[model samples]
Target: MTTIEAPSGRTTTPDVQHIDVLVVGAGISGIGAAYHLQHEQPGRSFLLLDALDERGGTWRTHRYPGARSDSDLFTFGYGFKPWRGPSIATADEILAYLDEVIEENDLAQYIRYRHRVTAASWSSEERRYTVEVTREDTGEHLRFTTDFLWMCQGYYDHDKPFQPNWQGMDEFRGQTIHPQQWPEDLDCTGKRVVVIGSGATAATLIPAIAESAKHVTMLQRSPTFFISRPKVAELAATLRALEIPDEWTHEIMRRASFAQGEELWRMSVETPDALREFLIESMRPLLPDGFDIDKHFNPTYRPWQQRLAAVPEGDLFTALREGKASVVTDTIERFTETGIRLTSGEELEADIVVTATGFDLSLFGNVAFTVDGEPVDFTQQVTYRGIMITGVPNMAYVFGYFRASWTLRADLVSQFVCRLLTKMDEQGTPVVVPQLRPEDADMPLLDWSDPENFNPGYVMRSQHRMFKRGDREPWTHHKEYTEERDILPTADLDDGLVYRR
Candidate 1:
């Protein structure tokens, strides 16, 4: 990396030093980008920065009691970095794996920790980005200009928690907390707990909290379709014994699993009555006799239309069956002094309340972006292959598919970024950006996910800001990494993404 002084009063680094590539967020996307860049372009210059002192974005940030990856380890693990742990890796294990990847690839040298990028502006005259970043430790600020930017920053923002305006939440005289900001020293053992919202986080939080909490009441506005399977360790073991490469094995298993789910999705959407009856029948035995499973278990949308909750080996169902846990499918009327009042005139008393509502999905912390000295609104921009933002030259953001393992999509995005950069270098292209035609608005790009603005208000917020193109083809989300493999690394980059030589 080279540093150069600029005439704009701020001491800047090489438009080239920070140039070849500037990867933000040290999570899966950042590590993946650095890993591929080092291998593909050995002599290229780059830097990776994260807000935290250590690496491993989400895996490091979230330390809830039983945090773990919902995706199978095979698919969740980096394609190049095969996960040797259980198929479903605990949060700790995932963090460790990220550490291993960083050390093994010697990516530490390229990473500048605690350097949180606040804003990035594209320079029209120089054809690069002027990034403003602050050091988290000393409050020291610095401005660095770069030729290219790679946003490996995941969709969610760290500081913001999704807390909806509850009728009497503020009036309650107790401590309330959101799972994303779970207190490290929190002690909920033997205390009555109420975890609100029904999503993946809720699923994970319920089981873990039930292990110690006196009584964990799960409150949901509506019941979500849930499926359970064995953890990744078992699956990984079976695949390893057969001498299958981790990525290949992972892709095959995940693809098959998703295909089955997709078929079910089709059924739920095509034959709503049959699917509803099937779901009711499956969950009939769990609820009290004469209880309406249709009211609670049935959703307004089709299965897999949003995201399906992954339960571990029917643990959640078993917990409910054994009477250790209970579910209340009702809206919160208000928060009482000691507990929450339901819309059904029922009071659920709790010593502690856990909001497992879900996450707020914002792209890059909702930072205002400028390309070529022109302000770019993400809502006004279209995503190139759902990775590169239009009008932003030489930059790529790694976002995941709702239907598949996150790492699979992220790794693919990382690989494609490296390839795109290599091609740019070979062709002597200094800048590249998506140049979608004005008439290309009719093409679909994303799947239908949480359209009702449900779960953890942040997702709804991000969805509103996101450019949703409903096409399920080359631009659509397939959720299977194998099917998408050829599409990214080998896709005609020049078709949608404009490359200037």
Candidate 2:
């Protein structure tokens, strides 16, 4: 941190927090970034700031029943940490893993909870960024300066889930809930329940709630492919039984899992029918007789176009088999006094409605950024190596891979930044920005995600607000971890960026 001195004979006051690096968000990404910073660039003063009052990001905020990770834990776990749990880990398990990461690396001392960063503007003359932050508890604003900024904030609006307007929705007498904001005191036992949407949240909620609800109905406009994943990993168990070191076990598990996922994705992209049939066949035996996989489980989009929903130990299928839950593939035309009216002229009765509709993506946490007092529009800037935005000095944002566990990309990004920072120190350069070459002036900017083809609602909604991508090197991102592994961690930092001494 930088020092402050008052005028002669006046008491010194440290009004502004200054540091070599300022990491935003104390969640998975931010914690990993801080860890790598301390490991690779020792003696650098940095601070980790989070708007929430805790360390866990996604897990800490979402408190709904049956809320858990769709992605497996071996890949989701940080590179430095070894996960001892099964692949299908719960939210609390993931939170515990994050806590372990923080304690083992001694990162808790540098973190400030309830510190929300409002804005950041880069000053070319000062070669530093002026950041505006507010304490959530007191609403008091503060200023900070840093040579570099790292954003670990995930995408999505934390305030509310995406809820569409249906006529008479508010007039309904039944209770309504969003999975993100599940009430702690509420009871669902012996009550008719309706869960809107067929994504991961709905998939997780129906089975978990069906055990208590009088009957649960999953209402959806379309279908999402469902797959049953084993709660225990035989290979991980085998590795441990063989006395392999924890680090090797972690690597082996990650690689084995990656290969399987890659093969599945490749089959989706190349021969989607084979993969789709395999998935449907896998589900057929788990459901009751005459259950229609085509109407309820099969998605119109090809496999891997969007992530498939996973259920722990076939709990969802068991719920369907036990006749505790049913699925409706129709849109809501209006809300009735008792429940909802479907566009297909069907009526559903419910005592509670859970709108798992989806999330509204919020880019950069709605924080405004400027360079030299001029606002920097994300639409005009192209991403450099899918991390740094063009012409933005001393900043990198963590955006994980959509096809794999989020931490895979997060860990790689942290490692990449550490490498860049190390090289910058050796070169005596303090500021670096990705500069678009003049030859690429005619390159047309495209949405970072190909959501039309992908059809994931969250990315489709927020694509316009994000940075653009090009078709060429360092301007585009591939979903394959092996490609990212070969490029991101060891990419030459001096190749395309402008560096200042």
Best by the lDDT measure: 2
Q: Write the per-residue lDDT of candidate 1 for residues 451-492, one digit (tens) a residue.
A: 532233455556666754434333434344546766776788
> Model 2 — TM-score against the truth?
0.95
Instruction: Candidate 2: give the clashing pairs.
Output: none
| Candidate 1 weakest lDDT stretch, 10 residues | 447-456
lDDT of 1 at 168: 82
Query: On a 0 to 100 scale, what is the lDDT of residue 332 in model 2?
Result: 88
Each prediction's number of clashing residue pairs: 12, 0
Which stretches of model 2 miss by more than 4 angstroms?
A: 1-14
Question: What would the TM-scores of all predictions be?
Answer: 0.87, 0.95
Candidate 1 accuracy as lDDT: 0.74
lDDT per residue for candidate 2 within 1-501, as digits (tens), equals 443443433233358879899998888889889888998789899999899999888888788888788888899998888888888988888889888888888889999999888899999999999998877886666789999999888877776778878899988999998888889887899999999998899988898889999999999988998889888778988889999998999999998989989899889878999999999999999998999889999999898888889888988889989999988889889999999999889999999999998888777787889999999998888898878989899999988877788889998999899888878888999889998777778888888787645778887877778888887877887457868988887787876788997
